[model samples]
Target: MKVKPLKDNILVKMIENEETSPNGIILTGAARGESNLAEVIETPEIFGEDQEILLRGETVMVTPHCGTEVKVDGETYRMVSYHDILAVFEK
Candidate 1:
């Protein structure tokens, strides 16, 4: 399924964080707290030269409690504004 965000809105999927303790104990994101990190699923097209381009599959950090949650085909997604995005991770 394809989903396109409107205007400066971006579609993202939450990325879960997993950590392993020194004793080999695994800890999930839920065990600690909800993660603010997300992967860009769909980015709004830029029509102006001043707008920055965000590519799909890029990991991004968003502001806490920002964006609207959405569900598509049993999959969860978040629609966040461009201003709410903090940083993008480089490969």
Candidate 2:
């Protein structure tokens, strides 16, 4: 099932990074640290007739450990407020 955020909320998928150890072992994001980086999956379509500042597919930096967790089709997503979005990465 597909999920859409309401109001100023945004749906995002966390971007995980993997690190290679000196012994050739791999470390996941969880081992290193929780990533604040996420990719925009969906944003509220309308907000007072003004276009949303954030667009889908844009990478964003959000406040750590914020937002509600959601699960859809076996994938995890975060529903965060627009205010929680610190910055957006330009393509």
Candidate 3:
């Protein structure tokens, strides 16, 4: 929340797979895997961290659905390459 990513650097908040469906259908957490798509909220500070350059807006989707996972502020998230991004969705 306090940290801001730089150019070409996307801060993604990985979404967790649903344990229960909207129709009252329930599924065990182990039954479903983690989500690959992540929401890009902010871009890091340019000239810092030393990276290529990505935008601040939009989501950076990942591929193979098996990337890297990160935990921030007691929350679980993920970080994947921009090239691995599949698509962006509106939250």
Query: To one decimal, what is the Cα RMSD in angstroms of model 2 from the true structure?
Result: 2.7
TM-score of each: 0.83, 0.82, 0.57
Model 1: worst 10 consecutive residues (lDDT sum): 44-53
Quality of model 2 by C-alpha lDDT: 0.86
lDDT of each: 0.87, 0.86, 0.59
Give residue 16's lDDT in candidate 1 (0 to 100). Answer: 69
Instruction: Please report, as a residue range, the 10-residue window in candidate 2 with the lowest summed lDDT.
Output: 44-53
Q: What digit string (tens of lDDT, one per residue) describes model 2 on residues 26-59? A: 8875676888999999987676555356888999
Inter-residue clash pairs, candidate 1: none
Candidate 1 local lDDT, 1-91, one digit each (tens): 7888888899999986658756788877567567799999998766356668889899999998889999999999999998899999999
By lDDT, rank the candidates, best first: 1, 2, 3
Q: Which candidate is the best by TM-score?
A: 1
- Candidate 2 residue runs with Cα over 4 Å from true position: 21-25, 28-30, 48-52
Instruction: Please identify model 3 stretches exceeding 4 Å from their true place.
Output: 4-7, 45-60, 65-67
Q: Native-vs-model 1 lDDT?
A: 0.87
| Residue 79 displacement in candidate 3 (angstroms) | 2.3
